[model samples]
Target chain A: MNTLMRWIGIAVVIFIAAPLVIVVPMSFSTAASLQFPPPGYSWGYYQQFFSDPSWLRPAWNSIYIATMNTLLTMALVVPATFALVRHKFWGKSFANLMMMMPMAVPHIVMAVGYYSYFGELKLVHSKLGVILAHSCLSVPITFLVLSANLKGFDLTLERAARSLGATPGQVFRHITLPILKPGLAISALFAFIQSFDETVVAIFISGRDAETLPRKMFDSIREEADPVIAVISTLLFAVVFAGLIAPSLIKGLRRMAGGTPSK
Target chain B: MSAYLRLAGVNKTFGNFTALGHIDLEVEKGEFVTFLGPSGSGKTTTLMVIAGFEKATRGEITVADQSLAHLAPQERNIGIVFQNYALFPHKTAAENVYFPLQMRKVGKKEGMKKAAEMLDLVGLKGFAHRLPKELSGGQQQRVALARALVFEPDLLLLDEPLGALDKNLREQMQIEIKRIQKRLGVTTIFVTHDQTEAMSMSDRIVVFSNGAIEQAAAPLDIYHRPATRFVADFIGESNLLEATITDAATGKAHSPVLGEVTCGAEGLPPLTDGQAVSLLIRPEHLKLSREPKEGRQNAQMVIETIVNYGDNAVVIGHAGDQQIRVRVPGADVVILKEGDSCHFSWTADAVFVLDK
Candidate 1:
């Protein structure tokens, strides 16, 4: 049973990791199209991906839109989470349901709704249209992450601060904000990823001027299987992998530095 | 001199549920008072009302003759050490202590220096740079104490601050807190359900039951002369016998278990003839003997159980239908056994009468 379980675990890991294995090497492949077991390996596609303005513009646009979506989502979600978690008022349950409504509805349905609504508003093909739509889609996940953090927060800390002569504003600034810094950062990261990876809404409202990276990738894959897509995918995976490991890496470096000074 | 901290007819209600019912209390400056009661009693609610965390719905609270009604909690200048310590996780011990000074607009350099000094006062001298999570529970308690006292606020309210500590540490923190409060001469109110903690620390204890003050007096007075049956039963171990005052003039009462009993005691409320009352005999005051001792009121009971506590033991037995507890020296317990008929004796001075 133990050996069988071990085999199953390894098989599951390999299955989950199959995409990275296929994508990373194919990114450097000398093949003409998106093909595995390539004829040869080179950095040719990586260079092309960096040099092409069409690919580059969408990459920058995705970054800009994701950043804006994160900011807007946090601005809406923070106060909403605090209210929903901490207070009692009329229609609170209704308000809570509305906050989580976008997560329940399908993204394709939302994309179709925004495509026409934004078109009538003369916002189609503009960066603001994509940003606004992504912000709405980002709200549920942002609120979920933030509200969980807010619930676990010891409210006695605020009362203690007040007793220590800090005003409500000062308590939030000095105690609540600093203590919740990590949770806020994680939730904002989730909002950014949601926007950056969102293809449906981006394809709908982001017609040409505001075409995002995911939409561009979708268009390129349909028209001509660009190996540059694999290069972009590999670069994104590296960026995310670096982000995931950065905290522990910093901690390890600090421990080494601290040990050296002590010795 | 007027009381430094006063709650006059303070009442708090959450919709229909009354939390604090007409509380009127006064504490002199530099006195350490404790609010002692079980959970859901008005002890912690009264503390919150005084700290401005919970507003008193009906009555006014004043500190130093200044009304606290118009002031927010920040403007009231009170310090609180919550039950959980409530230390800011992100801030180092020194930074946590410096926070109040920072809110007062003190420069960071001077504030941090003061914070370090305060930490030293709490016996956490070199722990200034460490975050709260790095410290042990007792050390975290000390840091919390330092943080609360760093600003020298008008009042310090501790809400069961040592309830989370282990037995040894809880006792140690109790002594430490009392010492710090004395050294600083801050008017402090500590809340706890632990009767021993209340007895060992407070200059005065206010006993609460069911949203009202049962009795507020010195610790020994509260133990020996509780004003009501609840206070008598709550403060310490007691054998509260149902009795009626037969003769108010001679201080005599009748108990079913002890037959006729002499009940005159100092500080007892005035009794009347035929007045229904409770006769309170403390467990420690009752002496257990093999035979009825001369010149002492005695009752025969069948010993049902003996709870030994190394130094002392409680002998629980029954006289008729009444369960009587007699605390005897642990060494004396060997002479007695369960199911043996023993005579428990008490003098009239040890029995106090409470009106039913």
Candidate 2:
């Protein structure tokens, strides 16, 4: 009876995730517009997404924005997280609340706010404008993730480094930065995803010159329900999905190779 | 010669909570001084303040006569070993030792060569390529010590450096650390709560309690002539009996447990003109006897309980309504089972006066 209930629970989860799984095969549709059951299987939309520079340019733009936003978020968040975790100071709680404030405010509202705010600054249709807009959303999540990671950090290691003749900067560089590798990598990847898959923020702040791929996909879906959007969506999902599974894959491979995972 | 390092009127506070209060200390070069205390007694906190991790709220700290108040930990040129060893998980054993030199920006080749030599000194030469996790806990600790010594700092601060090891490993590391510190001739300050560890390693011990220095002296002096009631209670096992000064200013007293006795101290209010005071007597100093205690060799009691702890026996006995313990040692020592009666007696000089 327990096994049957377990199977039923698993089936319910799969049923809830039906739409997401169904969208992947739609990218193979033979017809122009997206339809249920995909009409028939073909690589036409996929080829179109890669071949046409109109779609290609936004894809490249998305790549650039994601990379730059992730890097910028890391640069800002890592040190801030370090200070928040490693040092005691006044207004620390206030700083933490501000860092996590973005996660509380609805992104659509912030996008609207940023849209008007940047437009006043004459930054509405620029790459720097979108970069700044996306960064606002990305940096908070990056800081939150990295902060949680830093909580588990053995602060004694930094002290040990200092006692061994490491200046404050050297301790951060040698002891802190290297041990924070896993957290940094994970945060950067998630930060990239946070900006890459975001449609609402891109819709309000993105411009003709700085049109991100998600905004482009939104435009295509709004104008003429294109199957190519599904293709790009599936490709984006595949990239993120692979990232989520890579660590597990390596662990599984290690087990298969008869090597114990060393702490 | 003067002491190598000293903390004169060193005080520390975290807001209203006093962690260490007006601590005065000194340790000669090549001499190991252990700060012994219970948790929250400011032992590890004192070490951190010395290492510049925690700034003293007031007063001054000096290493070989140089003030260290404003100096950062790196600039103070002190080596520290934490309880956890704190080896960088990402680095190989050799790299861990080389980190200090690398931080000081020594050339890569020289740093690696010196780190290799340190690893060899720690008896971990062949394991240099292994990561910290790849080695045993004891080995990781050795690597940490080697790293701390890599820069050859003027002072070494150890915060319960052997605390994380098992009994056998801890003992082994204690000797290894002592040997290394001796060879290096660094003024070392060790902080630990374990009395046995302090007694085994330190040339002298500073006992702290309630944010103050309870006592500071050689191990034997601390054991024999503790300055306060707290020190005697902290350092070893003992029996404290309420007494009255029968002959004030003549080193004579009358303990309620065993009657009149001669001591080296008198003239305190609690023991004034036959007034009551506390006299602390070490359990081992009291011996078990079959005969009754008489004049000048007076003070006799009866055994209450005997605890056999493999190597020795602890016999707790009653003498005139007061309980006392006698540490009985021998291969064929008579083990007094619980509720079995026996006699107890000790010298008056073994009784210490606590005038409260």
Task: Using lDDT, give the best candidate's number.
Answer: 1
Chain A TM-score values for every predicted structure, listed in order: 0.96, 0.89
Candidate 1 has which clashing residue pairs, if any? none
Model 2: colliding residue pairs: B270-B276
The sequence of per-residue lDDT tens digits that candidate 1 reaches over residues B1-356 is: 88999889999999999999999999999999999999999999999988888989999999999999999999999999999999999888899999999999999999999999999999999888888888899999999999999999999999999989999999998999999999999999999999999999999999999899999999999998889999999999999999988888889888888999997568668888889999899999999888899999998999999999999999999999999999999999999989999899999999988878
DockQ of each: 0.65, 0.54
**What's the C-alpha lDDT at position B17 in model 1?**
99
Cα lDDT tens digits, model 1, A1-263, are 99999999999999989999999999999999999977899999999998999999999999999999999999999999999999999999999999999999999999999989998999989999999999999999999999999999999999999988888998999989998999999999999999999999999999889999999999999999999999999999999999999988998898888832221
**Cα RMSDs, all models:** 1.8, 3.7
Error of 2 at B219 (Å): 1.4
Reference-based TM-score of each model: 0.97, 0.88
- Cα displacement (Å) at residue A7, model 1: 4.8
Task: Please provide the root mean square deviation of candidate 2 (C-alpha atoms, Å).
Answer: 3.7
Global CA lDDT computed for model 1: 0.93
Candidate 2 Cα deviation (angstroms), residue B336: 2.9
